[model samples]
Target: MFFSKKKNKWILAAVVIILLLVIAYTGEKRERLTFPEEIVMYLVAPAQDLFTSLGQNIQTFFASISQYREIKEENERLRQKVSRVQEEMVDMEEIRQENRRFRDMLDFKEKQEMELLAAGVVARDPTRWFDTLTLNRGYRHGVEVEMAVITHRGVVGMVSSVSANSSQVLLVTNPRLRISAMSQDSRDPVLGFVEGRTDQREHLRVKMDHMPPEAEIKPGDVIVTSNIGTIFPGGIYVGEVREVDVDMFGLVKYATIEPSVNFNRLEEVFIVTSPVQEEPRQEEHSADGEDVPEES
Candidate 1:
């Protein structure tokens, strides 16, 4: 085995020496052969083609990666642009809605004959438990305390407090609010007091008292201001009768009224600048059968 290993090493050395001698001979022959340049080019053409193909593949791989990165970056930029556009569209839509609301309020004011002061609802009480709203108009705008506030649809509230530029209104749905109202269809008026009840959740409900037991009242009867109070104007819409009750007491009947305006969704209102007068009083008959005219 040792002799065989030594023999193998000698053979490897001989092969190396032979390869070196062959290389020297080939180099000398190449210098003397003087082959045509075209022929040499032809001989090396396949090798050049193989190297070129490898280089092109490497370049194509790098180019494809760069193109992919560019596409990703562009896609990201487009997505951000689309998101910004969508947000702007939402803002524009909100502005359009607000403009429509203001226009509707202006139209309502124009249709009325009474002196109206337009005011925006600035804020709702932080404690929503109380049905009170703050308005942008106040004493500066001729919004006096106890002045009635209303929307185009119907009555909203009465002014309770005022500042130069702001005022608090007591909503009709408040438990403490009371107003004398009557049915529009019938001339006989009834006294009703508005109250906020949990059962009537979103509307101002009135428990009408002093309605004559013989009075004809229905569910669909329209209720309006009787002008019995000094605050609200006569003929101003108050509410519609929803339910009625007649107890054993033969003289009086009560009713539940659903206000014409939805207080929960109130936004803007008109304040009555001038005082509303009650119905004109008739002359009284004295005990001596003489007619007495009351001073206006």
Candidate 2:
């Protein structure tokens, strides 16, 4: 407290130098703790171990998340593959069914007695005004006017016109096409003619006219072509009887029939190319007027 300025400055400088030396000494020996500090570290060792284990668990959790993402992506790809395989299987089954149907058609063609030319339905007439269809066969393939067209199931139509390689068929639903029909049951009359109704609103309906009022055609009777038909062959199936109606005078009767052929789904048919066989005519005569009954 009594020192001069020069002595005071010397004492401040000495104090600063001593403070620097103390800081240096502490920094150097900080790593080598005293006995009490070592005892404190030993007491906290388990907590440090716990912290290390927790950090390792966090790292493992992040690694698991990355693996799970990869697995999910792989599963999605597998599902897509399964979906494609299922689609292909469905397509294959359809192809198999088509092949079986065609095979059955070939067998039916062989069993037929008449010579037939298998033809495909090329195009359907877009004009709704007429019941007509185009066939792949034409004049070049022996398809001619009035040639009966039929499939394995039943009658379809007749060739109405022809080109060099294609032909048009007048379906049974046409108002002009009429075929003489007969009933399968002997009880029903042996004579009838199938003609399209005047309404012709639907292709599924037809009328079996020229039947006697006493004829026993029933709702389930099967009608077929008669032996007298000039256009269609005898014994060819026409349709099934749906209902019967008598005339106002009860002199004649007509029946509504459902055609056996599904014209809407017609795809392939055969044209009858064989010669027509006519039934033999029978004649009877009573010569001499049978007045020979005088018996001489």
Candidate 3:
């Protein structure tokens, strides 16, 4: 609707008066809020409080994430340290065991009268593990074919083949190996021949055969090398008799021998190079067939 001229002038005058009042109100400071100020604070207070709370929550979330990351790193470091310590303990235990073995071997070597060569077992044929062993010593170490191989415990085997740096030992468990053995009882010595049994290979047993039917050999009898053997030294321990049996016709007797050496755990061995030679004794005689007189 169109306003009359007088009305228009009155409207313009009212707008100008309102502008002057606003300018005066803004310039003057008051002790309490104006109606407009109160209305603006009422509208903005909840939004401002919400933004402040959200910011604090975000800061707390980031802090928690950082702490968790540090804890995870510490745990990882501890786990690695524990693993290294465990590995070191295992290595130390291995060294201790090895040292003990070496000491025992050295003591045994010193007590023997025969020329002994120390050698370590290095390998075995998977198919004939129970029947054969490979030694780290060979011709270069004075090892020779048919040489007797013995450990501190007892007889092991004989050297079958030799190389420049390694030798193959025919274990006492092999059927092809044989040793002349006898019972340890001097009063009733029971002579026999010991050889490995093909049928009893799974049990790692040997057969002491050729014992007379009337022989007094029985269970728990200690079998030892006899003077008849050219390869092995006399008096060397062979094994123990576990069982004795007579033939179907009762012509011969046999005994089951459990070897003194555990072939499965064979690690170190000694090769008999030769028997130590002894100096001949000189005989002293008196010219009168009486005690020799000492010169004063």
In model 1, the runs with Cα more than 4 Å from the true position are: 1-71, 126-128, 186-195, 198-204, 247-251, 278-296
Candidate 2: residue 160 lDDT (0-100):
77
lDDT of 3 by residue, 135-250 (tens): 99989988888788998888888888899999998877776666667899647889777777877443588888888899998899998877655577777788899999998999
Q: TM-scores across all candidates?
A: 0.63, 0.65, 0.67
lDDT of 1: 0.73
Better structure of 1 and 2 per lDDT = 2
lDDT of 3 at 288: 35
lDDT of 3 at 42: 96
Q: All candidates' lDDT scores?
A: 0.73, 0.74, 0.79
- Candidate 1 residue 208 Cα shift, in angstroms, is 3.3
Stretches > 4 Å off in candidate 3: 1-67, 200-203, 275-296
lDDT of 2 by residue, 1-296 (tens): 53468888888889999999877765684658778757988999899999999989998898878788887898899899999889989988978876776786788778878888889889877664567889998899888777888877777777878999999987777656666678887664557667666674645688887788888888889988776544566677778889989879888898888998887777788888885565531121112232110000
Error of 3 at 160 (Å): 0.8
Q: Tell how far residue 202 is off in model 3, in angstroms.
A: 4.7
